[model samples]
Target: MSGWLAIAGLGPGDEALITPEVTEALAKATDVVGYIPYVARVAERPGLTLHASDNRVEIDRSRHALEMAEAGRRVVVVSSGDPGVFAMAAAIFEAVEVGPAAWRALDIRVLPGITAMLAAAARAGAPLGHDFCAINLSDNLKPWDLIERRLRLAAEADFAMAFYNPRSKSRPEGFAKALDTLRQACGDARPVIFARAVTTPEEEIRVVPLTEARPEMADMRTMVIVGSSRTRIITRDGGPIVYTPRSVPA
Candidate 1:
């Protein structure tokens, strides 16, 4: 089969953060499929078709990319941030698992990019320097009860946390409840970093105590990170640096 499918990450928001491997795949792709904003990032060129679709249609998008690849079209599935992190790579695999028998034989690849969680953590001086865990705060795919359970458990284990899809206009209460959960579970007044639109022109990074991290301070565009008990702040002339110690003294 000459056709292949490449599930690629476009990085967070900055074009420069996109990996050279993903850029090469896009250049070779006969078709690009992704959410509207991600597809918009790919430059239009001759012999390349872009398929932009709505959010919640991941399965359909995956299937379409698979079919196109089966038909010998070089297809690239794009996602902002690392495609495997709450993004399109898993969706593509999910479709392939239940798809036609021939799909299993198709050449498929997942190209990595800088995920928002890491990008956000980097902007905050490695608040994730120690052991950490990433969680999707959006209850769209999972129950809120499960999310809360994991939140409490991660806190109980003293793991620094990075949250994605923290708040949206339609789901304002969830993040508020999350903040409350962390405050009650963590107990200590650790730092919370809110990195919004990282690497973009509108990028904003705000550091505040866990007690002051309001739901309103975060939006869908924001990456929220809550530090663990071992996390410390280095106050400097410019700004404070938040980082978790690399070791835990037993």
Candidate 2:
């Protein structure tokens, strides 16, 4: 078939941050599918169908996109931030792995975009400049105990951390536990950044010490970055810059 499927990242929020590659894929798409908000980002036009689904039905969404593509429709699955980073690309692959063998032969491509952590880091002056790890704080797919264990271990490693899905209405306590774990392991002096709605009109960046950070500061829209023990803060006329130095002692 002349059909193809492309999983594309729409970047954090700003239209300017969207890569040209993803933009071109959208322009050529016969069907655009994704979570409601991300799918809504695609402008409605003639001959382009938009399939916006709920947040939880990732496998169903992936399958719908694949079916459309196999039927000679050029389909694009749009994701906020990078698709590979805790997003739709992996879900699509999971569906492919379990589905009919024909899916393995379908033309598929992953078009990367600027993820939230990178956008958030740029706004806060490179808090992730050194060794860092990105963790999804929501334990929807995993156990809470495992999440807590990972948090403690990350702190012990002294790696800068960028967290996604820090808090949600259903699981408010997870982020609070994360804060407690960080405070105990990383101490109270390290910088903790709460970057909300990065690159959008509603964007807000706040850098506070671990002692001052409250779990309530973050929501589903926020990306939190906790500095390593060596991370520094530079106070300037404009605002404070948080960054990790590139070199370490031998």
Candidate 3:
């Protein structure tokens, strides 16, 4: 069939960070499907249809993209940040796995882009330079207990961490609890970096000690990183630079 589906990441917020591959996919797409804001990023072009949907409807959106592809339409499924990282790529695969057998043979590709964690890390000067883990604190797909357990374990293992969807209107208490758990497990002085709206006009980056970190510091637009024991902050005339050294004590 001439139809194919491409799940492409638009990167964090900057148009410059969007990869050429993703741009080409969009240019070739007859249909572009994604969250409302992400779909809005694609310029209006002749012969291109934009399907913007609500958040939390990933399965339905994936199915729509697949259906459009099956009809011989070149479709691009857009996502912010890397599609494979807590984004549409997994949803697409999950739909395919449980979907029709024919879908398994469809031409599908996942084009990676700069994820929010990486973008946040770079803006903060490489707090994730060492071995690190990424965690989604939303608890929308998983249980709160599981999130807490993972946070404790990550701290015990001394792994630097990047967190996504840290706080939302409905889940404000979750991040507060997470901060408390991290403080109890990781100690009082570990640095926590809150990077909001990275690469966008309203971009703001803040670093605070774990003890001083408050739940209100994060919002849906924020990406949070909690440093390992070795994460360091260097204060310069411009600002502070955070980084984790490559070597550790023997």
| Model 1 residue pairs with clashes | none
Off by over 4 Å in 2: none
Candidate 1 achieves a global lDDT of 0.95
Predicted candidate 2, C-alpha RMSD: 0.8
TM-score per candidate, chains pooled: 0.99, 0.99, 0.99
Q: For residues 145-205, what per-residue lDDT tens digits would candidate 3 score against the true structure?
A: 9999999999999999999999999979999999989989987599999999999999999
What are the lDDT figures for the candidates, one per model? 0.95, 0.94, 0.95
Q: In every candidate, how many clashes are there?
A: 0, 0, 0
lDDT of 1 by residue, 128-221 (tens): 9889999999998999999999999999999999999999999999999999999899988989999999999999999999988888999999
lDDT of 2 by residue, 1-250 (tens): 4999999999999999999999999999999999999999999999999999999999999999999988899999999999999999999999999998889999999999999999999999988888999999999999988888888899999899999999999989999999988888886589999999999999999999999999899999999999998899999987899989997898
Which segments of model 3 are wrong by more than 4 Å? none
